[model samples]
Target: MTELKKQISASLRKDLEAGELILPSLPEVAMKIQEEVKKKSSTAHSIAKVIMLDPGLTAHFLKVANSPLYRTQNSVQGLPEAIGLIGINSVLNMALTYTMRTMFVNTEGPWKKVLIHQWNEATELAAIVAVLADYLPNFNSDHMMVAAMLQNIGALPLINHLQHFPGLEQEEVETLVEENATKAGLALVKLWGLGKSFEDVIKARHDWMYESTPELDTTDLITIARYHYMKDKQRLEDCPPTSEIAAFRHLEELDFTAEMSMQWIDSAREKIRAIKRMLCM
Candidate 1:
């Protein structure tokens, strides 16, 4: 590693070791949505009211509710209708995804370009994962999409920190992220009090060898989505063949062949495009 790389890595390590890393927190609207979701007595209208407070989130929620992902017969006309159609859990997840995405929109720095690229890649993977969830059992497409979007979230703070070091090249910062993102991400997730699912998925997202009793879990779905993203970007050499991964191995029980996976994604190209547009990517 170069001197700059060493400095970046050491600083991150010291922070992590000392539990002083400044992780990002969820937006207030997202927190309110989560609080509403947790209240067993909360009604759809109540959640809708919280969502409506943020006009941008309200618009995105309505757009996603009417998108091909939900496939509602009629367009969702308002926040209440959108909540009723998409469910409180899904609305909470969408709101979180939207809010987390806004945190990455840096406008006046060299890091802005890198942050934009990362956000686009994240949204793309998220869309693909949401579509792919339709094929799996007991999986919430919206929730999985949110998880996929957050897979590399640890990199955001690290990249933000790198802005202070002018001599560090983008490549070096990316390399550091590749090596330490999971650790940083887990810390962030824990700090935010996200559920165990978020913690598990973020912790094991990059571990191709991860296996669970059910064989098919959020981590597996994320791995598959990530594999497709890398393959589409011609970065396959950096990862193993999708079929060789533990998640893919378990998915084989469902007779999920590589060709089938590709065909499914190919068929949903238009849907994916629609989701990206709704996400403002």
Candidate 2:
């Protein structure tokens, strides 16, 4: 690593060790839904019932269902209709994604804009990952979709902390932001008691291969998700020179090639437009 990257990483480790990062309390509804899902007794319908109570969430869910990205039977008028259109797992993922988006909106200043751009990039890549995962053999697109949606969550608390600490220069602070976001995100997944597999996906996002052993599918989704985020060049940078991306780059080893990748890129653009139109983004 370059001296600057090493310095930033070391500093982030110290700050994280000192507990200076200001990780957000998980959204209440997301917590509730997670708790309900963990209750082996809870049915999808039960979870769906609770989610319907949040009008903003409910409206967003319906809007997502009606988006041109999803070919639905018809316009969804209610929570059940929306859930039916997208399936239980998809609804769950969408709820979590939407909740995360709301939290990012609560930040202010340059960091707020930076994080918003990151979230938007993540969402776009996630949508493409979701679409491609559907076609990739042995892939669980649902898990991939949710994981991709949340991969950058580590950055939020780091930015929050930067805002609270006024002494750092903008450029220097941004380096810390990247390092801590990765570290804090990994820490939050562990602190929040997510599945080991989920934790592995978040932590190994830049790795060359999926170390969690679930399947290479979800890792591929994360790979592309991060790639698209980096491609935006506003919130982040060009894709990291890491083994994880190289693994994704070897898609030509599969039936797919560089040319085919463009389809995903194009589809993601269209999906973003459709979502923006629906949500007035």
Candidate 3:
């Protein structure tokens, strides 16, 4: 790393560790949904009522709920029915994901393209995670989707800061953003009180080959999902095949083969596309 990168990285780490990082604040609706989701007594009706208060969000939720992705034989007419179809966990993820989506700075900013690129990449990985998790009955695809959606969150603050450093080429900007993203990401996850599990997933984003317990976990699913996403994007520079990936090796229940991987993606393509459409909307 250059001196500039080293200094920024060290400063970010220190600030985050000290709980002094200037993490972005969550909007009130996002905060309310997050708090409501944490309550044991929270229900679809109650959460729906809260969501209903925001006319715009209500419209968006209903649109997403009725979209082909979540559509069923019966149409979803309101928040309560939407929640019923999409589930409470997904409702929470939707709110959080929406929160991230709204963080995009004004369109005129120099970093707009970078922000959109990173955000779309995150959502695409999230779509992949959602579909991949569908194959394993034990995993909640909704939770995994949220985990994957947050993988690039650290880049947000880096992009925000880049507005001040304009003459740097895109490559230098990318290096700066990636090098300091983890520190910002860790602080954001904690600041948002998203739970320790999320914190673990955030840390694991950098460890593509990390392996843990014999049983599979959110982190393992994310590692595999990210690897596949990279492969699909043709961005997997030196990443090994599934046979050589630790997460793939560790998650024995998958028994994933190269051919099986391709087959799974093929079958899940529509579901994945629908999810990406919903998210991008």
Please name the candidate that would achieve the greatest TM-score relative to the true structure.
1
lDDT of 1: 0.80
Question: Which lDDT tens digits does candidate 3 get at residues 141-196?
Answer: 76887888787888877777666666656666777767767677877887788887
Local distance difference test values of all predictions, in order: 0.80, 0.66, 0.76
- Arranged by lDDT with the best first, the candidates are 1, 3, 2
Per-residue lDDT for 1-281 in model 1, tens only? 79878977888889877877777777888888888899999988988888888898888888888887786667788788888888876877888777777787743466666767767888898888988898778999889888987777887777777778878787876777777778888888888788888888887766877764567788888888888888889998889876678888777878787677778899998988888777744
Q: On a 0 to 100 scale, what is the lDDT of residue 214 in model 3?
A: 61
Candidate 2 deviant stretches above 4 angstroms: 1-11, 18-20, 39-45, 140-142, 206-215, 228-246, 249-254, 275-281
In candidate 2, where is summed lDDT lowest over 10 consecutive residues? Answer: 235-244
Q: TM-score, each model? A: 0.94, 0.79, 0.88
Task: Summarize candidate 2's per-residue lDDT along 201-254 as a digit string, tens digits.
Answer: 677655545445433556555775556555555543445543335545556557
TM-score winner, 1 or 2: 1
Superposition TM-score, candidate 3 onto the true structure: 0.88
lDDT of 1 at 186: 85
**Model 2 TM-score, 2 decimals:** 0.79
* Arranged by TM-score, best first: 1, 3, 2
